[model samples]
Target: MSKLSTYVHVPMENRITVTLLCCASFVCIESLRKNWRPALTHLSNGLRIIESLPMSMLNKLRDTVSIYGSANNTEEELGMDYILRLFATWEVSCALFAENFKPVISVKLYRGRELDDKPLDEFESITQAHRAIVQYTRDIFALVWLFRDHQGDDQFWSQPIPRRQHEILSHRGDCMGGLFERFMAKPQAPPSGTGEHYSLQWLPPTVYPNLIASLGIEGRFKLWAEDPSAAPGRRFSASNRATTSKAAYEMRSAKYPYRSFSMKHNEETRHTYLALLASDGRLMVFENEQPENMSEYTPIDELSICTKPSRGEEVSFKVRFDPNPDPCYNAMQAGVANDSLALVVAGMAAVKIYRSRDVITTSYGVAQTQREFYLALEVGVHRGLVRDVAWAPGNIRGHDIIATACQDGFVRVFRIDTPHSSNEGKSWSTSELPRYENHQVQTCSRAGQLNDKQQHQSGLSASLAKSGSHAERHFSGQLGQVKHACKEIAKLDSHRTPVWRVGFDDDGQILASTGDDGKLVCYRQTPSGDWAKSSELAIVKTRMATP
Candidate 1:
């Protein structure tokens, strides 16, 4: 084996010798167990040599022999099938756990149309278990490649898994799950008459956890189906104006070319807010009446997402409404309320988060809502174009995690820890006015018997004048209130291709991504509080021989 490692780069004409060396190296590595490091080196070298050979030659060799030599088979043909199986095992083993290893041998030897084109049961030559392991691992390798190629693809990750890819991941995951179930459900030993023998439940060994972790690919199909974003967002078209014909609001601005727009609904206020991304790098915010009533939209405030005008025309932006508002905002003048929300915008290679506070200004004899979005955190990783940005749901951790898929083929996660503030425990009271119904406006403490000056000061006059007026609040005011400390918790480049889309699981625990490479990769936070790669799946396309 030691000598074979040195001669791994030998001429390709010596295929038989190379194959024998690879089989021997793999056998030695398994037998030596504790002292397998040197054997592994030999195996890696020999496998690389075999991987470099043409698929045609390997196929010819495989077809000439069976698992056991037949009467018609010559000495050269004996054990060829077993040798190929050894190569396949090594390829999968390297991909799952080995360092800096890829599955070149498997790809070269696979005669199927594509790993994802068939279910495990469709394979005829191998046992069900063997078939599942081989096909799934190879499919995962293809998935990783796809993920790398399409790292910046939004549709791949955010939307429903493509039909072909979906079938592959789903089928493989089911196969693996069944295998585990069968293994655990093995028949128990027959009870002895004399002694009471309990049927012990079968459990996988501890080493299986690491191996089973890769089975996450099986659940990905179900996860994608459960994702809210799996269904495409409602589309609005000006040409076919039946649904959106009645304009909620229109900003006739030739001066500021609106690059993109995002809308977020506040459950507390039951009002929808619109954010228009201006090419000038500023965001224009507008307030709407209610969820059902969308006929009117009033311009509220505008803020900058970027310090300077971005040269790139492509922009991606999303808005998130924080459930908890800073208790400090609850004290802003009686009857006036503040809302906490955040705007994440990306252009070029930069992603900026703006913490916004919608302040209900009750001045000029009318109550109105105004928003102020301040730049809170910025991530300027030298990664290429920022393709997509996702803000995970639920803030149980008392912080926000923003995931970005960049053209440089990295899915980076940033953690923003801000002060923990809530308006849950606080209470508000109402006072009656002569002309209007008793308005229960959100106030700090001043309850009853207010003079005219106090009425205007407490914003009771505006509440009295307007019908169904409420505050749309987001990130509190004071520039320093927003956390500037953005920690990059994870920077994953396993895809090795431009990532186009990123999305979070419901609980914000798992993050999945897809790229132009046609692969999907998932990451999850471990109990140790570190983000690690969980699983991978890919759409493998293969070339057919010309008829």
Candidate 2:
């Protein structure tokens, strides 16, 4: 306390003396000043500081509030708080209004037809019938084109002009005017000899209320009403009588059914279905319902069975398999031959071979023993686990080479050597070796398979040793070192997951691969002499539900 009092007293005395001196000095300075320049300069500096104070304080306040405030809060309680609250409420109300409102409109189709005659209740049915008619007309047009191109016949074309003109006139009358005059036309008697009669006729496009239009004699026909309660028995009889009158008309009603649809040709034991490209370059519709007769081959130019409309049909290419039967999954590999013969690898223990020239027939070439010409290897061990097989593009030493990729992350190439001498009884022999030319092995990592501590410790060492041993044994031996003239030309790591299927283009320039990832990767050999993935195409992913 004593030291603090002494220091405070000295400072107070010094402050008083300094204050008196500063006052005298200020008075002297004022007396000596001829003008007010120094005082004005000091005033200007003070004004500048005052001007900057508000901005500095505002920035500090902003930083302090930001540090303490909730980020989600939109409004601050300084000036204009009420206005901000009002704006926020308005924004919320606008959002609510937008959420609750929905826009809708009734879409109608308007052509040169009367509103009163349009079928309002049977709108859906009328639309479907109209679509079917359009398709049928297009098909007829295509057939006409094909007939002209292939047959070079002008008679079929020249004969139908008058009929087409009559049809066009009828369409104009029905469409432009509300005319039910043709509806009142007299009914003609059924044709002679047959209890029921049918005739092919065309109807003018018109909007008939609750009615389906059918062809009639001299601008006359019956209206099949859309009412379910309106005589179902009559409807069936009328439809049948219309279809059965002529052989061409009856055949037009024959239905073609398929169990499934695929872009490529698919087959089972008794039936085969192919997707035929129509002459007009459109994909014809495939019927999934089973056809009535399996024995009859339906050409791609048949008519509809239910509607009796002429439409393109589908055909099957048949191949026969001989002797005993063996069921195999994903075994057939298509080859380079223009004929659609698929090389089938089958059998449970020892893989047997068969070739199907066509898919429909069960008769095929007899099974060939695989062990006769090649090294005696267990089918299940070496080739039995073969998941995908491919045929090389070019002939290797006058023999075709086949490559098989297995489930155990290995690929092997085999050459099909047909015996040169006619004295040799066997049809074919094989020479196989591991495909190692310019190929790299992607070994499974130890971390991937190790489950226990002991396994983890020994995994790396064991894998390394096994890899080394295999390399020395296979690559160092004389047979292994000898590279066949027909070694694997290219090897690629096509997928991260397992590759399920492989396909080659007609020219063998592009390779397409599919895998568990549900992606189709196309590879092309580049100018740099490396197989590089060119593009990836999207595929529909199929998921199998667990039982």
TM-score of each: 0.43, 0.22
Q: Pairing residues by index, what is the TM-score of model 2?
A: 0.22
Please provide, for model 1 over 97-204, each residue's C-alpha lDDT reduced to its tens digit, 9 standing for 90 to 100.
766566666555443544335443332332444555655566667466545556667777665554456466667677776664554444442222122211111112
At residue 60, candidate 1 shows an lDDT of 47
lDDT of 2 at 488: 44
Tens digits of lDDT, candidate 2, 224-246: 33334448643312232322321
The candidate 1 region of ten consecutive residues with least summed lDDT is 217-226
Residue 22 error for model 1, in Å? Answer: 32
For candidate 1, give the lDDT of residue 407: 81
